[model samples]
Target: MSKEIRNLEPTELWNNFADLNAVPRGSKKEEKVIQFMVDFGKKLNLKTVVDHVGNVIIKKPATKGMENRKTVVLQSHLDMVHQKNSDTNFNFDTEGIKMKIVDGWVKAKGTTLGADNGLGVAAIMSVLASNTIKHPAIEALFTIDEETGMTGAMGLQAGYLDGEILLNLDTEEDDEIDIGCAGGIDITAKNVYHEVHTPSNSVGFSISVKGLNGGHSGMDIHKGLGNANKIMNRLLYESQELLRISEINGGSLRNAIPRESFAIISVSSAKKDTFLKKINTTINEIKKELKTVDANLDISVTETSTPKKVMTTISQITLLNTIYAAHNGVYRMSNDMEDLVETSNNVARVIVKEEKITILCLTRSSVETSKFDLANTLKAAFELGGYQVDLSGSYPGWKPNVNSAILNVLTKTYEELFNSKADVVACHAGLECGILGTNYPDMDMISFGPTIQGAHSPDERANIKSAQKFWNYLLTILEKIPSKN
Candidate 1:
């Protein structure tokens, strides 16, 4: 555990967070963390069990006077998005997150802080280990693989949890409560073609797009952030007449707005000057358009050694056209809810090498039909370019119930404690509540947490003051959980 973070206010929460961050818990690869949670539960002598899907559940009887209150499930995903700066040297698999306190916020050094759900997991740990904090019967649900596909939640068994209420401490903003969230599907396109040697008089140049603020593809999609893959493709499209792709690679994760892209191409030597001028002009235009949202965006071109093989002109055209056609930002706004995104897509990843190509996208929507609508649209665009597209990992959305019992409880409690009403909103990101509710539909579910910024990116951080405030609110809310009805 980091000494500085352990010394933060709300030591109970921060200390546990420090310990949790010591374990590398990336999505899909969570065996170590799963064992860690199981060990933690057993150490506390709680009724611990691991489900078939590797989800950990530790049950604790209610505090002395609160045993009559309704049972509540304190839930949070154990896995977090792993992102690092291009210049930062860090191995996520073998190393723990290194944290520092800056301007009243806890941030990791050049890597994701894992506060997205790690803080939530820590909060649960505090509550489960506490002997004095008042609360009803508790079923702590620690799930895995939430950042990528929510596979852990999807595979959770029906009878494991006996809670009547589920409090998901995964929301990023401390001032708001979330009752609903969008569902999502992964869209992947793949193809293989023959490679050809570069033309006799071709000159090689490397084009790179970097310095953009890449963030969570779902939560930050509407902010008009730059998609590095899309920007690089734009330049390629403009210089198609003189350029042939030797290799192109962009983005890393399927759920983050890409931050950088690099492509090596060969251009006819006679048209080299014209290509440079065209690319510079396009970069200026792109800068102007994204000035407000992606202020740090940069695109550069430099000469490089020639490669023996390059994609044929036909393949290059098909690749450029397909990426150009796919949508990269917000697609529709909700008519029913104010300012809520109804449909969106993130051209998350693009890669071309050895005559093989793959383009991946994530399409999201709260409405079921609209989700498929946008997904199929992308499928058609890629298919038109001779790529086979697959849409999978579809998850359900959590529809809002304005009259929810827990919503009323949270509203009343917030106003009583802080003299203000908490904003009730639905988010564009996928939350595990929707999937967990499938088996336990009667469980009233809601999500809220401390303010976190730049999630899914290296700049991710958690606010110290907000963490303290959220901690107090959580304890108060637990003590007030309605008695068994």
Candidate 2:
């Protein structure tokens, strides 16, 4: 048991979270966590079922007097996004996250805290383990690969669950209840590149951008933080005439805003000093432009070993222009809802290989047509650069239900506990709710969680105070669950 986390408020919840953090559960590599959950369910003597794709469901019978209430499902993902800083030496495969308390927040050491869904999973585990709290029949669903593919939710069968109400424990804000969310699709664009011998009298230099606060591309798209890939593209485009590209690489995931990017280029030795100066000037200008959102943005140039080959000018130009022209960040705001993002694109990753240059992107929108339209726009941009484009991993948005019964119960419970109404909102980020709803069309779902910041990044943290309040609010909601007429 972790003394640091076990001492926090809502001790049961935090303790469970600590235990989960002890295992390596990165997306698509969640076998150990899945086994732990299964063993946990057995220890509690609860009815546990592991679905075809590794989604776990643990069922607990209704308390003595609440047997008449409708069955409820408390859902969260088991796998977490694995992200670490460039300077951090932590490994997600063999080690548990090192957590620390800072100013009343629980954060990891230079790595993602996994609080995006880990806290939710802990809350569910606590509830299942509790014998004191009154509640209706409960089903705790732990899905897998939510960060990378959402494969667990995708493979869930229609008749697998008996719940009429689903409480998705994945939202980040404690004061807001997410009733709907945007759908998304992943795009990969690839182009062949021919490398020729390095130009005579040229030297190789590496340019890099780092220290930007990259976050969940969908949720943080409107923050105006720098995109490392886009920044690298701008610099390359500006220096195309004087440089020959040897390699370009940025970002690793298709759903995270890039925090760092690097490119290797060959430049004439005579212009080395001028080239470095120009890049430094560009860095300063960019920093000034994004100072409000990204205070530590860093761009620097350093000499590197001369490469034997560089990209053809035509290929370099096409690649840079394609990246420069591709849309990034918020593309449109919702007309129906105030302060809602309706459509957006994230140039999530870029890679240069000996044979090909590939770019990966994710586009999201609550409206179906807008999502496809944005995908078409990206396809066109890459096609014009002679790249083949493919899109997959598409999921639908969850439309809001104003007449949701569970929503009424939750709202009433929240008001009774805190004397303030919870904000009902729609999220721009993709949620498993959107995909799960399709199989269980009649279920009423609402998403909420403790106050978490910097999700999907190394700076991710959960507020200790909010975690307790969120846990109490959830217990009250479950205890007061109303019976279906």
Candidate 3:
């Protein structure tokens, strides 16, 4: 066990989290962790079932006389988003996370801490192992691959679970309860490009944008941070006459905002120095504009070996125009919920390979019609740019029910525990609750968790004190669950 979390309060939770960190549990590559969980269930003698889609369900009988209370499902995804700084050497497939403690928060060294859902998974494990906490009949559902595609939640069969209430331990804030979340879809645009020999009397250079605070696409879209892909395109479009593009690449996962991007281009030798000067001047101006949110942003150009092939002028224009015209970041605000984002899009990734160039984006909204409208808008933009667009992985939003029994119970419990009312809010980010609700329409669900900052990026950290508070609140809620009529 790492010394950092070895003696933390709520010993069981931190202990289990330490073990989880030792396993390689990146999205979709969860075999070892799946087996580990199964072994844990077997060791504890709990009733465990592994579904076809790799979701793990563990059933625990009520403590003593609480059997008459409703069956509550404590749910969290098993997979964590893997992100690291460009200079970090960690591998998600073969290595474990390196943990540290800084300012009372548990974080990783130069990589994502995996506290997004790993902490939730550890909480469920600790609850299952406890013999002291009083609670209703509990079904702990550990779904897989939530960060990327949500394939585990997607494949969950209807009637596969027997719970009237679901407690999603996936939100980031400690004092806010999330009752609703936005749905989202992924849009991809692809087009073939023909490469021609680089124009004579030209020199090659790499223009790169880096040091921006890329974050969770949906959660951080409104922060006004610089998007590396968008900024690079803007520069290219401004210098279109003097350069011919050879390659363009940026971002990674579809759910993360693009933090860095690089483009390889051939510039006329006679104008190379002037072009570099203009690029540097423009970069400084853009940085000034985004100084508040992206203070560390850097854009630079460096000479590189000459490339034999470059995208034809037509292909280069089409790609650059499409990127420049794409809509990214928050597009609308919620009318019903103050300060909540209603609709947004993130230009998540751009890739240029031998056969084709592709742009991957995600659009999210709480309103179904609005979601489709944004998807259609993306389609039109790509088609106008002479690329084929495909939309997939569409999921519905969870509509808040103010009169929910579980919500009332949770609110009362929070008030009694902390002497203050918890804020009932809706999240702009997509959550599995929306997808799971379709399979169990009547499942009353609420999502809340300890404070996790900078999720989906290398800066992610879980507040230590908040984890204990979250645990206290959850256990109290379990004890206070209403008995069946």
TM-score of each: 0.99, 0.99, 0.98
Off by over 4 Å in 2: none
Candidate 3 lDDT, 1-485, residue by residue in tens = 39659689888889999999999999989999999899999898999999999999999999999999999999999999888888899889999899988989999998889998999999999999999999999999999998888889989998668989999999999999999999998899999999999989899999889888888988888888788889988888888888889988899888888888988889989999888877877787899999999888888899998778898998888888888888999888999999999999989899886748989999999998999898898899999998999999888888888888899998888999999999999999888998999889988899999999889888889999999999998888898888886
Query: Tens-digit lDDT track for model 2 on 47-95?
Result: 9999999999999999899999989999999999999999999889999
Better of 2 and 3 by lDDT: 2
Top of the candidates by lDDT: 1
What lDDT does candidate 1 reach at residue 355?
A: 86
Whole-model lDDT values for every prediction: 0.93, 0.92, 0.90
Q: Where does the lowest 10-residue lDDT sum fall in candidate 2?
A: 275-284
Supply the TM-score for candidate 1: 0.99
**Model 1 misplaced stretches (Cα beyond 4 Å):** none
Per-residue error (Å), model 2, residue 199: 1.3
Model 1, span 18-92: residue lDDT tens: 999999899988999999999999999999999988899999999999989999999999999999988999999
* Model 1 per-residue lDDT at 102: 94
